[model samples]
Target: MDRPRRIAGEVWVAVGVLAMAGWTLTEPAHPAGFITWAAAILVALGTAAQAVTGSLRWWGGRLCGGVVGLELVGAVGDRFGAFGRPGSPAVSWGDWSHFQAEAAQLVPWDRLVVPAAVAATVAEVVLGVLLVVGPWQRWTGKATAGLFVIYLLAMIPGMGSASILEYGLPVLIGGALVSSARGDRRATHQSPAVGRENTLAADYK
Candidate 1:
């Protein structure tokens, strides 16, 4: 089950990278578009890092966590830089506000959208770090899963079917990561017992 989930996660990450490539090809020839392109690539890298390092937990966590940390930083930059609008001269609070406003339309929390977005951003950075340096696997994995679920839901509205489809693969990858996290933690817990059994068999031989 763990192997299958890891494989699926890898495939999903590859699909996400390809989808972002296609988006790059089709997007309007504008500078601001690069921000979205870069963000997608960073996310794909993080997903792939988690998928590939099935055995090396520490390094895997670092790779995945670092990329996500960078991603959150980029997102914060987008908020202030107006998502790098071509003509904007300074921080574009308007762009950030517009984004949360659209999300407000879908959920019944109009007043909470801004606060939620802010909290999510901060959570992303903190959780990403904890995933890297902490021993709390289940907790970090659950938090990451919750964050991606919010992202998936917020994406459904104001996007075309194709765009939505492109985004869906990442959600699947995130789910796979969550499963892998649990599986890995269990494996870690059982490894010492397995080692002891092997040692006993060798002694008997």
Candidate 2:
């Protein structure tokens, strides 16, 4: 909630995401799993770089953009892999099988997964674009926070540990996003009270 604290939070979050993704990448799972892991790290790297370079100016926008772009790339991979032949490349980690199970049980899951993936991917792209250009920025941040929360919740009913972590990563990202967007830290940093003691001493002269 303060500038130093905000910086500290961002640093820890960046570290956590990189650490989680790095471990996953080394562990060797499905291609989908690897891609998701890879994407998380990639976004974290890009985000940290951008933050250091001052690309965001504000706190959250650039990081959100980084993840949105990363996930959009992931959406492409997921759509391609999900639509591929069932046995092709051995369909890593049973996601294909889970989709099959969901399809069989729900009848509409097949239809839903594809469409939901499409819509979410499209939304990510749109939000990314909005973030880059200024006017629509606030909406993009809110949308990302909302979607990340939903994804995290959705992971609960049956999403395995990996999937749960996958979703959790973004939820944390969104939390940072919300924190950055509100930017009470930045405001407090600039507030006179923050340095009023020093100012008061000078005034006595």
Provide the overall lDDT of each model, using Cα atoms, as 2-decimal numbers.
Answer: 0.50, 0.47
What's model 1's TM-score?
0.58
lDDT of 2 at 56: 39
* TM agreement with the true structure for every prediction: 0.58, 0.50
Local distance difference test, candidate 1? 0.50
| Model 2 weakest 10-residue run by lDDT | 196-205
Query: What TM-score does candidate 2 get on C-alpha atoms?
Result: 0.50
lDDT of 1 by residue, 61-140 (tens): 34544444454455456565535663454322336665465456545666787787778768866765665454454455
How would you encode candidate 2's per-residue C-alpha lDDT over 1-205 as one tens digit per residue?
Answer: 2244335435645665755656557755632355555545545554454344232333443454555545544443443465355455433223444444532332335567656655655775675555444333334545655666565555655454455465435534543353333222233245556544432332112
The local lDDT score (0 to 100) that residue 179 gets in candidate 1 is: 34
For model 2, the superposed segments whose C-alpha errors exceed 4 Å read 1-12, 15-34, 50-64, 73-77, 80-125, 128-135, 166-168, 171-205
